[model samples]
Target: MNSLIYRALVELIQGLAVLMVIAYVMTRIPSFGDLLNRRLSLTHRVILGLVFGLMSIFGTLSSVDIFGGLANFRDLGPAIAGLLAGPVAGGMAGLIGGAHRYSLGGLTAEPCSVATFLAGLIGGFFYLCKKGRPIRIREVTAVMAGITLLHVLVITPLMLGLSNEIRQILKAVLLPMLLVNCAGVALFFFILQNLHRERLNEAEKHRIDSELRIAREIQMGMLPAPSRTGDPRYAVHAVLKPAKEVGGDLYHFFVRDENRICLAVGDVAGKGISASLHMAITQKLLKALAQSGEEPAGLLERLNRELCDGNETMTFVTLLVAFIDLRSGEAVLGNGGHNPPYWIRRGDVSRLVLEPGLALGIREQAVYTNQRLCLKPGDTLFLYTDGVTEAMNAHKELFGDDRLKTALLRVREKDPEAICRGIMEDLAHFVGQSEPSDDITMLVLRLESKEDAAAGAADGC
Candidate 1:
């Protein structure tokens, strides 16, 4: 009886080994290749089935001593097959292997084979469920407990009814096998958890990048292009350099009529899509008011009222709007919580000092003040957003208002295009290979009187 049981156990183990090999081969097939593709859904199912099949074979073969008269059924391959195959596969392997053993050899000594097969099946299930995720300490403990109970209730009782020597040998071998499978399962679980986390992080980064691209497109569309102008004496040049895909800075120049030029620059309160949307709305409102023959201060006041009427978020904007009369060379300027602009006359730079009022979108009844400046021949006005002064260097020092004023003095004689380019170049160099911290905007208006230039420098003296 002992020889037959041992032979049967060995045959069962061989059958399980064949099934493990079959699973590995099937995984290589394209249709089933995905199962072997690491942490995939089908991979988990295949691994589980392989483990159960191995366990069943191991238990069955051990019951019928098929090999040459040997009574020892000690083999690591079958248990290892279970460990690698995961829970479902391991359980099925165990069941099939156990049944084969019982059929080959009569139920002699004890029916411990049934219990051993069930333990293998349960272990396989636990491993399958936790294939791609982390395994907690509790999970390890639970698996160990289940394996121990199955062995004690089924295998131990049957072995106890057999000879003392047989029982003692089986006890020594089974304990070591259980320990090996438990350790393997715990290690694999930890590895799977880390992989899952890495995949999630990569996905999140891609989503953020996609959103930024969309925001950049909308922001660009809100600004006026160089080709939009129709006047000859009044030339306008503006540029926007965003530190990110979308930024808070904005500038627009439009000819409201043949004799009047309406221009405005603003900086929104935040960055990205939200700021860009606010900039679009502000530009539209200002253009509408200017086209209706409203004065600079009146336009700003109306814009503030519209912005603050029901807005509870308190998101505000710093703005500067100037209406230039081409025939008279006079400009009416409105200030709304923004930096003072520079007026350049014959290569000399001076600040246009005016009392700045509250920012737009803050108080519903806010008032704005206007200042007037007459543009003589060869005179220019430069308007900008705060991005110019807020640029940061490698040492984290801000290129503040003082530096900006100095840059303007250095480039006052250049044409409007050159002036805009020179200021941007100086800012980039000052930053010294550091990333820009905000959006940079610059608008330069050079008003040249047609009569003065045609009279061979009328004011040359």
Candidate 2:
């Protein structure tokens, strides 16, 4: 073996072995294990990603110069991020590491950057393949081994377009890098597996479940009760099903100024507690803004600004708002990165044409425009979250928009209550025995005739 290869391999192995020992000790510490066992908040999760990114930076800065090219563990941070935080955070760590590597110009800079990014991305892809469960050792080993292969096959070869330089670089660093990364990942995960196991306390689990149940109750309580709206000139029926104990889907209705009825539905960027909290904030801001009697477009603008203000988590919500004239049934609708609603007009279903605004909290300066339409008696306006159309079945199929349109046409002649129930029934049947993949929400609005209102009253709509 060449002296350079021998030195690189020995140094890398020593460094990685020390790192593994330190990590193992940290996990063995009760305080550190306690911290690890706690459920991470959004801020903590973001910090975790940043920590991994920092690790990537460290890997680059501490690289060993072998002849001309540097042998580095730069991709390790991103790969670990992918294993722990899923795709987005893993990809972010890769970008951070890649950006730093690119800043330091070298023959291998571009390929190393690409290799680092893929390491994180592919690691995350494997993490998601397990569907939110703890990944098996085989998968982790496979990811680590794959990273080693990527470094040798792609990163080393692409260091120089010339074969002589590429071969020299590969001979020096390829095997060392592979050996350290694969062994390091296995040892690190061996420590982490214990931490994951320590979090399985039944009492702690029950406490979390109880808290989530209370939160779900409070969230459900915040939704509008159509029966309490005081005006029955129009009929509105809505449904919401969260994929978790708490979800980020929103649907609300309120009688504004005794004439206009504001109907709205929204979906936050993600699900679970963080998203649920974000939805609550959006709901409060929305209700407060809508009470000022603003038009749908203007209301969204104000809501967007409010959401963007001091938003550290960078969460976003896609909303659709409609203000309907109680007497004339004239409706003005505005959208922000949400699924465009379908207008069911007696036997015909049409997707409404509206300016698709950006989701709120994305940017403070987003513009919004309104689309106007009239709802005649017997015509129903249907609004929903993506969960309805993207609902999955046991066979890994989505209940797509085509199915939604077809299903709507079949029940177009029914009342708002019946229409809501019928579509939900179809969705449930289509998704039988399969886990819900997301938060689902649906709202139906109809301009009720006098006879229709009387029937609605009797049916407790």
Best by TM-score: 1
lDDT of 1 by residue, 1-461 (tens): 45544444445455444544554454446554334335535557555555445544543344323222112221222233344456455555555555555555543323544654665556556666766554574576456545644554446556555465555444444433344334433433343344346556767878888888877876687778843445557567888988788887878788888667887889989877778777778878878877777888999999999888777878899999998877667789998898778898876788889889889999888899888877766788899988898999999999988888789899887778888989988898999999888888899998765674324233322
lDDT of 2 by residue, 373-415 (tens): 8677566789999999999999999999999998998888887
Question: Any idea what lDDT model 1 has?
Answer: 0.66
Q: Assess candidate 1 and give its TM-score to the true structure.
A: 0.68
Misplaced by over 4 Å in model 2 are 1-200, 226-230, 451-461
Instruction: Please give the distance, in angstroms, between residue 338's alpha carbon in candidate 2 and its true position after superposition.
Output: 1.2
- Which model scores highest in lDDT? 2
